[model samples]
Target: MATILSIIPYHFYPPVGGGALRCYNILKEMARDHTVYVVTSQPEDTFTSDEDYTLPERVVIISISKMLLHISGSSACKKVFNAISYRVKKRTLKGPANSFFLASYSAIISLLKDVKFDVIYYESLESVGELSGPIRRFSISFTHIYDAHNVDSILWAQQAKALQNERLMNYANNALQLEKKLFKCIDTFFCCSYEDREKLIRLNELKISGIVVPNGVDISKKPYDDDAFKYSRKNIIFCGSLNYQPNIEGLLWFYTAVLPALKSAIPGLVLTVVGQNASYDHYKALMEDESVNFVGTVPDVNPYYYSASVAIVPLLSGSGTRLKILEAMSLGNPLVTTTVGAEGIRYEDGKHLLIADKPQAFVEQILTLLTDKQKFDTIRQNAQKLVMEIYDWQVIGKSISTQIPVLLKEKYGGR
Candidate 1:
């Protein structure tokens, strides 16, 4: 077994969305045979939660070193120190010189002082953040594997364009430049989808080899009651992180364009927004809607997934394939997602899941599932069959377990 350091900006467990889930599952897979040491952080006080998350049995965990809080004076003095040191954090592009990220970088450097890892696995762009330039030297001895959860450059650029802010546009440019430098330091570039791989190669003009490690579902969890839809109510479920801009954008669109019409057509139609707690201020409309239920951050999403007559993803932003689509389909929700949501994943539009872009089209599909049991069951079964074929984490993780060891041996002479 090899010793590996899994580095990321956020805590992967109790994952609220695809990025965190990707980090957790991949590191869990690596820990099956490798001695994986995870270095991750919880978000600041505002977004922090008490939700319990159990890590895989064999992995070791390290919270980000709060060296910033180690000032030798009074509490007020420490505040003054942080204000003096990182007063510019809000002005800099996100992930560049953030306190936690800087501290995590410090922890990694401290680890490297005494620990020579066989592989240094960075989980996402947020994981690499602005530390790529400094970490470049360590790449000489360590097998640097970058698991890009998404092409964040494109996402940031889209955000920039949508907001039409000059400052955001500058930030987007910085993200592109950062990615360019980051790719140069990596040994293997792992893309969640072929689309992302194509975008990364074309946009960054990377010479490094890119591998597709598609997002997967844990099909091992007793096969979520495929027949649950038969008893479920007139419920529509949207399960994802509300804090993510894309999901928030999608929900806003759904509420504005589709939900009103859907409710009129199908009486008692309920939309339950699951996953992280959505702020009333951020999601004012979604919060106040009479037909919506906000079930924030459950220990297990299977109940919400199973109780819904249909699952929906109306994503208008973000890059990479959506794990929500795969997860809902795996649990047999008979999903209705936009083309953007289904990007780079293999599935038939009508047979495996419903693909809708416009308000009318989305309503039609939801109605089809809500009213017609046979159609719902057919799509449900087809989705489960598809998930079993390719999206199972057991299969995906095992592939990593087998291939990564070979790569390590070839590159650095295995332990």
Candidate 2:
């Protein structure tokens, strides 16, 4: 088995998000066969000490302090600035302002100075430029696989437009430039979706070796009880990290356009929004209407999934495959999402999922699903079948594993 070093800004365990979840699942699978070392940032929770954050057996976890690296900023700004500075300096600005950058840079240094590995799996090239100098220094023989979890720069640009944030727009523009420069340094790249891969190819004009390994759900873990599946309740659930722009935007759209229509069609139609890092103002605004409920940061999301009659994804702008969609599908819930929201997943309109673009269309789709139990059941079964056969973590993990040997062979000559 090849030794693999993965550098992600965040780790799998604490303070879960989609990227963290994906990273955790993939690393766990990879660890089954390979010696995996992960360097990620540690969350600042008073309850959880350093000793509490443990890695899996045979898996190494390096936790970097965010305070030392100066990784403080609004989420969008943080990613863009990190991407740009990393591209130019190859070392992050030192201090509390950019700790994530410092953490990542330090981790790469530690890997080069302390450990030996066969392949370097770098997730999200947006901030990877920070390692360019160090990467060049150690660039002689190791295989480098750049994993683009999302077309981050594109998402930044889209968010900037929606929020009318000029600083973010400028950052997004600069990040795109940095992304192009960074792409050429990697030996191979992997994207989470076909749309992301295509955007990387078209925008960067780089024909680098890459594959689409879509995000997946852990199907082996038995789902929550069918009794928890409250088909009798007229409840619609939208789940995601509430702090994320795309999710926030999607929820706002649902609250503004779709919720009213659904309530009109089926009175007392309860809407549940569940996620972490939700601000008081955000929750307040959402809960202004008595029908909407904000359930902040649940330990287990299964109950939320089970309680829903339908799962809604009303994303206006974003890139990459959505884990929320996969999770909803894997749970056998009927989904009503916009075309953009369901961009990367292999689903056909009116088949495995119901895709609607306009607000009115979304409302109609939700109403249709709510009213017709037969059609809802059919879509739910189809979604579950699709996820089982195609989007299971085991299948997707193995696809990623198949590439590891090829990368190793290319670097070590069939070692």
Candidate 3:
């Protein structure tokens, strides 16, 4: 078994978003056949506490801050200086930059001493810079595998378009440049979708094809149920990390444009918004609306999935496949999403889910789905079948685990 070093920016203790879910599953798979060592960050609250996580026995987790606190404060000061220096040096260049020089990474630098790893897995381009200190400290030949969560440049650019912000556009451009530079050191690229893979190839003009490892659902978590298609009070469900800029923007757009029209048509229409970190005050008017119910973060979203008549993803801009869609579909929840919402997933528009871009078009589709029994049932079944066949976490994880050994052999002559 290979001794792999995986670096991630956040803790996967309570896997929440797409990125976290992917990281958690990949590590879980890797630990099955490898001695996986993880370098990750925790909330400042966990800085002094010994917290037990849901990790396999083969996995060894080391907090970047946990190691840093053992070192003098001067090391952190130097890290800050380095970050500022690097920013100033790159000021002439226009592109997105990774958050590598964070003080936590500086702390991580002190912890790589005398450790050995056959391969290094970079969770995202953002964590690419953490390798510099480790590489400089230990001169070893190890394979570098980059797991591209999203074409972050395109994602940022989409956000720019959605919000119409020039500053975000500039940040997106810079992010593209930084990612391009980072890819130069990557031996293999594990992309989330073919769309993202093609973007990488076009942007970098690469000779080799990327490995597609799409985000997926843990099917074993809950049993599949077909009751998600039941036509009740036309209760609409929207689930995601509400604090995320794209989700926030999409939710606001739906609240303003689509909900009003739907409510007018069906007097008893109900919209259930479920997820965490939502700044409720930002949408005070929407919150006060009698029909709209915000069920802030819950332990299990399965109950909501089973309760709602239809699930909606009115996303205007984002990158990567929607985990919410996969989770909803796994429960046989009928979906109504925009083209951007269904970007990475391979789904037939009318069969798996309904796709409508315009406000009026989206409202029309929602109304039709609520009123039409046959169409909704067909979509619910098709979506469930698709996810069961293609997006199961067990399958996706095993695929990555099997391929990594081959990649290691190809890159460094052995696994």
Model 2 worst lDDT window (10 residues): 46-55
Give the alpha-carbon lDDT of every model.
0.76, 0.76, 0.77
lDDT of 1 by residue, 1-415 (tens): 7788887766556665777777777777777777888776653332334345445666766776355355333577765655555434333432323566546656777787777778788876655654544565544677788888788777888877776778878877877886776657677778888988887777666666678888988886526565644634788899898877788888989999999999899788899999785777778877777789988788788888777778999998888878888888788788899999899789898899999999999999988888888888888889989889888877788888887888888776775
**Best-to-worst TM-score order:** 2, 3, 1
* Per-residue accuracy of model 3 over 1-415 as CA lDDT, tens digit each: 7888788777666576667878888888889888898777654454332232266788777766554443323576765655564455344233232343343454444545556677778886766643533453454577777888888888889878877999989878877886666555666678877888888877767754588988888877745665543865468899999878889899999999898999998988899999988786656776788898888788789888778888999998877788999998888678999999998898999999999999999999888888888888888889888988899987887887788789878877784
Q: Which pairs of residues have clashing backbones in candidate 3? A: 95-173, 95-174, 95-175, 96-174, 96-175
Residue by residue across 1-415, what tens digits does model 2's lDDT show? Answer: 8788887765457427888777777786787778888766655442143342344576776666554446655589886876676555544454223455555666666687777677787765644654545666765566877778777788889889888999999878877886676556777778888878877877767656568888888875536234433455788898999988888888887787777877888888889888989877756778676788778788778878887888988998888888999888888678999988998899988989999899889888988887777788888888888998898988887887788898788757766
The RMSD of every model to the true structure, in order and in angstroms, is 4.6, 5.1, 4.2
Runs in model 1 deviating more than 4 A are 42-53, 71-102, 126-129, 136-139, 165-167, 228-232, 409-415
Q: Kindly provide the TM-score of model 1 when superposed on the true structure, using C-alpha atoms.
A: 0.85
Per-residue lDDT for 95 in model 1? Answer: 35
For candidate 2, the per-residue lDDT at 79 reads 69
| Candidate numbers, best lDDT first, in rank order | 3, 1, 2
TM-score for each of the candidates: 0.85, 0.86, 0.86
